[model samples]
Target: MHSFVYLASQSPRRSQLLEQIGIAHRLLVAQDHDPEPQDPEALEQVLPRESATDYVQRVTGLKLDAAIARLQRRGLEQAPILCSDTTVSLGRHILGKPESQEQAREMLQALSGKTHRVLTAVALQSGRKRLTSLSVSSVEFAVMDSAQIDAYVASGEPMGKAGAYGVQGRAAAYIARISGSYSGIMGLPVFETANVLRAAGFAI
Candidate 1:
């Protein structure tokens, strides 16, 4: 087992989840000086006609591939690298992070008193081997008044989150119930993540 693995994610919740399982990890984010730095943030564009599950899985794989190359470029210590991505879907329609307050409010209004699917895809890459997992959770949102949606959007927490909300944040109040992995809803499913890490020869 490696002393620690590289977690190529920007979400603090992913890091917190890994720590919960006692897996030592280091962030593997893009450096400002890279000759060919790809904007990790921009890799999340929803493809034309892509389904939610397909979108999350593809993004996660792309992220892992990028991280693997980064590890090689940085000459970092050899260890499995983990990457994951999450997306919220109302049926076939994907509700990504809102680009504006109006969009956020629209997403919130659409989700009010409705159930949505949150899909999180995770990948672990160790040299020539890779393991992957996907977690799909059902989240039911309570009906929210326009005022409530406006207030939440004003808080700015909905800007960069899937479905314009976070399960563990202020948005929790709007979540009537979740029928899947809570940790998955938070961006990393501990059970699935641990399983992949273990498969990649991590101690966890």
Candidate 2:
């Protein structure tokens, strides 16, 4: 059993989720000055005709691969490494993080009075072994007028969140119903993550 794991994600929610489970982990984020850096934006680019499930899982795998390489490059101590990716989709349309307030407002408007699927994929690498899991949740937003959408966007909470909103933030007021893991909607699924960690020989 390992004493701790390495989490290769910039999302503080993921880290908070891990902490909630009593899992000790250190961030293994890439540095700008690294000789070989992974471009997060490039890695998250949606491919033509890609399904939400495929996109989230593929991105998680790619992130794990990059993290594994990062560990080797840094000669870090041997331990399990965890990586995850989340995407919000309404049918075939994948809603990624909004680049600007206008985009955020547009996403919020589209999601109004509708239910969308939030898919989160988690991957773990331990020694020569790798494991993965996916969690899918549905969130329904109540009908919102332009003012409501604009108010939320003005709060700036949707700027860096997938689906242009965070379930645990001010956006929660507009969430009429949630049919899946709340933690998953926040960017990490605790149940799925704990299972993956256990599979990787961690004593979650």
Highest-scoring model, lDDT: 2
Clash list (residue pairs), candidate 2:
none
Q: What Cα-based lDDT does every candidate model obtain? A: 0.89, 0.92
**What tens digits encode model 1's per-residue C-alpha lDDT throughout 48-158?**
999899999999999988888888898988888998999999978998888889999999999999999999999998778889999999999999999999899999999
**Residue by residue across 105-149, what tens digits does model 2's lDDT show?**
999999999999999999999888888999999999999999999
Off by over 4 Å in 2: 35-37
Please estimate how well model 1 matches the true structure, expressed as its whole-model Cα lDDT: 0.89
> Clash pairs of candidate 1?
none
Error of 1 at 9 (Å): 0.9
Query: What TM-score does each of the candidates earn?
Result: 0.95, 0.97
Question: Which candidate has the top score in TM-score?
Answer: 2
